[model samples]
Structures are given as C-alpha cells and as structure tokens.
Target: METFADLVRALDTNTKTNAKVAALADYFRSASDSDKVWTIAILSHRRPPRPVNTRLLRQWAAELAGIQPWLFEESYHIVGDLAETIALIVPPDPQNETPLGTLSDYLNAFADLKQQSEAQKKAYVFKHWPGMTYYQRFVFTKLFTGGFRIGISQKLMTRALSQATGIDEEILAYRLMGTWDPTSVSFKALVLEPQLEEQYSKPYPFYLAYPLEEAPEKLGPPSQWVMEHKWDGIRAQLIFRKKTLFIWSRGEELVTEQYPEFQVLADVLPEGTVLDGELLPFPGGRVGSFKDLQKRLGRKKVSRRLLDETPVILRAYDVLEWEGADLRNKPFHYRNQILNTLLEQLHDSGQRYPLDGSPALEIANWESAALERERSREKHSEGLMLKRKDAPYRVGRKKGDWWKWKVDPFTIDAVLTYAMRGHGRRTNLFTDYTFALWDENKSGERELVTFAKAYSGLTDAELRQIDAWIKKNTLERFGPVRSVTPHHVFEIAFEGIAFSKRHKSGVATRFPRILRWRKDKSPEEANSLSDLKLLIP
Candidate 1:
C-alpha cells in the first residue's frame, strides 16, 4: 500500500510523459504480480465495486475526526474533492510499530467491509485507520470514495509497461484492450504470455488525423490525396473474424450487442476481414442527424422501433485487415483497391446491405477541393478527409499524412441566463454557463429559453472577468446554480444543430463553445429560438 501510494504521488507530481512512464516502469519492476494486476485494473477504470457508500465514509470520518458534519461538508466543498478532504481532516495513525498491508490485502479487506454491519464497519475502519501511514490513508480514502484520478491514462500505462517488459507497444496495447478481469487473470498470462494469432475480436489502434491549418494548395496536386466526406457519426471498426461479427467503437468499447442491425454483415464480409469506418444513422437512404443516434448510445438493449428509426450504415472509409492479412502497412491506394473489390464481391454475391465504400473526390485541384469542403454540411458531412495516397495506416495521431478539412462552425449570439461553479480546478469560479435564446410564445413578447451550456473556449482573463460579473449580477440562487441577469450576449459556435423534443428550445446544438463575448449585442438583439431551429439539418 505504501509503495502504491508513493507511485501515485510521484505520478501526480510529474507533468512530463517520460517522467511518469519511468515512475510506472519502476513500480512495475518491484511490485508483486498480484499488486501490479490490481493497479492496472484500478487505473483502467475497473475499480472494485465500491464496498463502502459515500455517506458512511463521511459520517465515520467526521465522527472519528471529532468535527461537526457541517464543518466537514464545508471542508469538502472548499477542497473540491471528497477523498482528499477526508484524508486531510482525519487524525494521523498512532506512533507505533504496526506494519502496513499490501495492495492486495487492502483490496481483499474492503470486500469484507460490504458484508459487515454498520457498527462492524466503524470498528473495522477504526482498526485499519490507526495502522496505515498518511499516504496509505489517502489512497484508502480514495478507494472508499470510488474515484482515484491521478492523471494517468490507459494509453500511458500500456506505453510504460511496454518499456518495462520489452514488448512491442502496439502488441501490448491490443493485449490490454477489452474487458479483461484482473482478479481472474494472472499478470504473466495477461501481459507476458504469447497471444493466439486469431484472438478473433482484437482491434488495431485507430489512425487519427490532424486538422489542416494551411491552405490546401500547399499539399501540391489534388491527385496525390484520396478525398472523402468525413461523415458526422460514430467512428467504429467492423471486425469479421472467426466466422463472427464484432463492432468496436473508436474508444475500444464492444458495441456489437447494442446495434444488432450490423450483424448481417457477417454473412457478406469474408473471414479475417476488418473495416475502419463510421457507424452512421441513415434513414430512407439519407443521413440522420447526430441527435437521432444519441438515443441509442448507452442503451443496454436497443428497441425494435429505434432500429427502424435510425438504421445503422457502415461508411467504410478505410480497411485495416483483409483476407486474414494485416494490410495496415500497405499504401492507401492498395488498401482501397482491395476494399473496393470486397464491396463489389459482396454486391454481386447478393449479400450486400447498407455498407458503402467511400469514393475519391472528383475535384481537379486544391481550390476546387476547398469549395467542395464548404458544401460538406449541406451534404450532412462534418468535413472532407484528405489522406495521402501512399501513406500507411499508423497508430494514434501522426502529422502530415491525413487531414480533416472541416467547415467553419455555425455561430449565433445567445445571452448567458444561468451560471454555475465548475468542478476540480475551477470549483471556486463560475466557469459553466447556460445560454438561452428569445422564444416568442402565443403572445407577442419573447421569453428567454435555455439552449446550451458551455464551460470552455473562454480565456483565463475572460473567465475571471465573467466570474466577477456573475457574482455581482446574480438574480437568484438555486443551490450551486445561479440565475444571472441576462444582459451579456456571447457568440456561441457549434458544429451542427438538430430538432430535439427533450429540450425547451426544441433544438439541440453540438459542440457549442464561446467564439467571443458579443458585448455589442443586448439580450433583445440576440438570435431567436426560431433562428436556431433554422440551422437544424
């Protein structure tokens, strides 16, 4: 536990990726195999099902600390974190020769806490509290509270592990993917063991694109690039391995069960075929708005009506694997040749469904391509994807080879109606704001109606100025939320808009951010709800 706590502290203090990787590598070297597995699980968002409730921890903490509950609550708010506040307030363990426990020991003991009675829990906490060091107590409290965010990502962990074990980072990444239970698998089997060639549903890391900042002419001839519409949908990989179909999101979540419509592709796509594409919601052969797909995102099970409403379409942009061979290292044109051939084979076999292959743009030059990019939104595309014809599909974000030339975002002036304090670092500041547009009811007058909530895109100085203004202009307070006088209007920029029945404004905007403070406009001068609805595609 002490070693784990020390590692956590070291990780938190370090900002550089290399330094953090070194610290993780060092911990992996000394820690027991079991402890290492648990650490991986915890950092990968697989924390043990919280054995203790938050209320119990707070009550027990305040009771043991000899402080009022109100005092503890105040401290918690000021600190902006529950776990850290309890760690700070609690008295240190007694000065004695009590040896600390191992990481596995702590995990095992916490599971026992669930079965114990309230009095037994208090007794157990008291017994354990006095034996642990300060760092151990802090980590223990974090376990009790349920979130141990220490600035480490799963990607970073895999990179560090690759360094420690002399394994290829890509192989290590694939091994660590999916829902692997740490408690069931040993560290050696999970990491060091040789994997089966046909692991079946394993996904290759996604190749990402950087936004094109310069003029398109700088890239030379248009013939050098394979241009395709970047559809506004979920980035997914369709895998047909071992005579089965598996759909994985860009985040590596297995979403095969959620969208059952894609299962038919198993019969069409041959074995050992893998496609990197966008999972678009297309109804009546036309692209559905992003708002239509949000209804099915986190559902454990999708309904029949939803399947009919938003039929899933796989827009195959790139093919990573074909005919049981890894074609990621091949040039873009070669891969597309195979991809087009596969699509044609499926079509002629009478097994073709809604899966569509992307075609290269017919633009003659960079200037013409730019004009085509401007028409992206009209065609329900987020942007234009310009991939080098000779480039290979590499892992993660690499510069120069691929670029997403997205259209300018839709912007509108909206008044700030409500303000709320942000979490973590900006907890003391009113950084989050709910903006609204004037909506005319059956009557002649227009009323302010909530539209979008934006927390980012404002500079530090602008945020502080707004925070001060929010404090002075607050009209009413509802707990953490405050109704501010709607005098300030800000230009809100968004990617797309869609009609929504859930929102009061009857429209929802995607990725709304503060473009700039529109001090020139009043609340009355801001765009109306009807105007916002007009932008819905």
Candidate 2:
C-alpha cells in the first residue's frame, strides 16, 4: 500500500512523458504480481461508479485545507489545476514510513510473479492490506483508476513508452493502447501487435491520415491527387479472432453487438485477421444520410427494423493486417498489394468486401484533379486524402505520411430572422440566431430562404447586446425560439450544402456556424437567390 502511494507521488511529480513512462514501466516490472494486476485493473477501469450524492471532493478538500469552497475554486486558477491543489493540501510526511525507492523495482517485482497462479496472487493481495484511510482510498482510486485524468493523456503514455524502451515514439504508439495484463494473452497480445497483418488473416483498408504541415502545396495540379469523399462516420477496425468477431471503433469502444452484421462477415473473411475502414449505413444500395446513422449510435440493442433498414458496409480504404503478419512497417504501396490480394481472396471465398463495382465503395485510380472535379459536383464530400505508396504506418499525427485536402468552406450573407435562448452558459441570452438568404420572385419581390442557422462566433458582450436588442424588438414569440424583425445580417459559414427535399428552400447547410455579423450590410444587401444557388454543389 505504501509502495502504491509512493508510485502515485512519483507520478504526480514527474510530468515529462519519458519520465512517467519510465516510472510506470519500472513500477510494473518490479511490483508483486498481485500489485501489478491491481494497478492494471485500476488503470483500465479508470473511474469508480459515481457515488450516490456524496459531497463534491473539492468541497471536502477545501474544508481540510481551511479555506472556503469559492476561495479554493478561485485559487484553482492560480494553481492551474485541481489535483495539484489537493496534493498541496495533503503533503506526505516522513514519520518512519517505508519509502519505496524506484518504480522499476516495483514493476520488476510484479513482472517476476507473472508465472504465479491467479488464486495464489488473489490470496496474497487479500492478506496484504496496509492501513489506508477513506481520503487516501479516494486519492488512490483517482490515481490508479485513472479517474484523476489531468495533465496526462494516452499520447503522453505512448511517448513515455518510447522514451523508456528506446523505441521510436511512432512505433511505440502503433503498439501501445494503455496498460493491460500480459497474463491475459487475448487482450495484451492485441495491443502488442496493433498492426493489422499480425492480428487478422484478411486485409482491411484504412485511411492513412496526413499531417497538415507535410501536405504538398501542389501535387502536380489536382490531377495527381486521388480524391475521395471524407464521410462523417465511425472509423472501425474489424477483427475476426478465432471464431469471435470484434468491431472496435477508433474511440476504442468494442461495438460488436451494436453491429452484428459485420460479425457475419467473419464467415467470409479468413480467421485471425483485422480490417480497417469506415462503418457507415447503407440502405437500398446507396450510402445512407448521416442523420440516418444517428439512430444506430450508442444503441446497445439493435432493433430488427433498424438492422434491416440501415445495414452497414465497410468502406475499405487500406489494408493493415494480413495472414498473421504485421504490415504496419510496410509502405502504403506494399500494403495495397496485400489489400488487393486479400480483396480478390475474399471475393473468391464468397465473402463480402467492397470493390470497384460494389454499391458501398467508390474505388478508382488516384486522381487528384478528377477528384476535385467530382467533389465540386458532389456537395456531400468534405475533401480528399493522399497517401504515399511506401510510407510506414505511424501513430498520432505526423507529417509527410498522410494528407487530407478538405474542400473550402462555403459562405453566404443571410438575414437574422429569429433568435433563441441558449442552453448551458448562455441560458439568459438569445444567442442562437436563425438566418435566411433572399429568394427573389419573378415579380421583383424577394422571399427568405430559411437554409442556415448559427450559434457561435459572437463574444459575451456581443451576445448580451444581441439579447437586449432581441428583447426590445417586438415580434411574434414561440416557446424557446423568438421571431425577430429581419434587421441584422450575418455572414454564415458552412461545409457541404446539400439539396434537401424536406427543407423549404430545397437546400440545407452542413456544419453551419456564425463566422461574423455583417453589421454594415442591410437585409437587402445580403446574398440573393442566385448566390445561394451558386453554392448548391
């Protein structure tokens, strides 16, 4: 227990990624098997269940430190963090306590006992309770369980591993996915071999994300670039390990049950393989709308109707794993060779894999110029991604490897027709404004095209001023939305303008947000029907 506390203290003081990784590696390498398991479990679980209506931990900390809660809250700004403030109040004392020296000692001790039986280790931990208080337990839980997620991130851990092991940070990142018990071969093995080839017998397509800084200014006009519509959907890694199928989202959530159809793909895919691609809704041989996918997310149980209506397809882009080999180190062109081979294999095996003629996939030769032309014609596409034929797989964002050339945002000046009371911090203000563009009639009279809405880009002072103006201008009132006189013109910016049969203007804006208020322009000076039509694609 003292050793665990010491580990926490050491970690608290060490902020550098390398130092933290070294400390963790050392702790795991030396700690008792029981202690190591506990640590891993705590870190994996991260946070405890929210205790039923207990006083806020900060309030208790303030009481113990002889300060008011408000004062402590204010002081948080000085310390720049909450955990540090609590640590400052509970300084460790040296009253003949058995101080644990180095983290490596702890980890080595723990790793040494990996061969021990599980029952024996359990019994050992049960018998080894060093006196711990409720407050101490709280602090310990926060540290070990990762509930105390502050000043640290998984990226930092990856960096630490790189520093400790003398491996490239990118290599470490590609392999590490937080702490896990090596004894649990199923989970730990997956982390140790995150490359798609080692884990899966079949090949999967993945987008090779390019760093913004590394993207070339001119890839020989848009013609050299292979453009594809960057869809807003879940990035999933599908694995058929043994007979069980697992679907892992980029967020690391196992969503196999949520998407059982993909599991059926295991019947066609070779066993012990992983594939990477976007998991998107496909209905009636066409990619379903993003709004259609919203119904499937976060649902633990899939309704029969939803399963039938919104069947998903894997939009394969890159192959990661193939036939128990880790191809992450292989260049993109080599991986593509494996990917193409696997696709042919799957098709021959009567398995489902998106191909050139498949309704779910749009595969073609890499052509940046042609893609730009296609993107211009298709408003749903966000941009194009470029991957080097021979770049090794890397973790996190790196330059010169992957590139995403997004389409420029579409902007238009629109009249502020309505305002609504905002939620959360802006509950008192009507900050959410509905804006419209002018739709001219043949008789020279203009009507409003209610196409966009914006709720951002305004400062607190601006919000307050707008709120006051909204209140003063008498107009029809709805429950939360208030109709206001069309006096203010705002420059609304958005990505992807799609023709919507359901909307009054036959068009809808994607990601519409306020860029700025055009205070100098009158409603008449705002964008006309022709301007809105120009942005149709």
Cα lDDT tens digits for candidate 2, 112-204: 534566555443322221223334433542542234553445555545544544556555444443333434534234333456633332223
Please give, for residues 387-438, the per-residue lDDT of candidate 1 as tens digits. 9999999999999899988999999999999998877889788899999999
Residue 481 shift from truth in candidate 2, angstroms: 6.3
Alpha-carbon runs more than 4 Å astray in model 2: 1-229, 348-380, 419-431, 437-451, 458-484, 497-508, 525-537
- The Cα error of candidate 1 at residue 448, in Å, is 2.6
Specify the highest-TM-score model's number.
1
- In candidate 1, the residue pairs with backbone N, CA or C atoms under 3 Å apart (3 or more residues apart, or in different chains) clash, namely none
lDDT of model 2 at position 182? 37
lDDT measured at residue 147 in model 1 versus the true structure, 0 to 100: 79
Q: Which is the leading candidate under lDDT? A: 1
Find the 10 residues in a row with the least total lDDT in model 1.
Answer: 92-101
The 0-to-1 C-alpha lDDT of every candidate, in the order given, reads 0.84, 0.60
The alpha-carbon lDDT assigned to residue 261 of candidate 1 equals 86
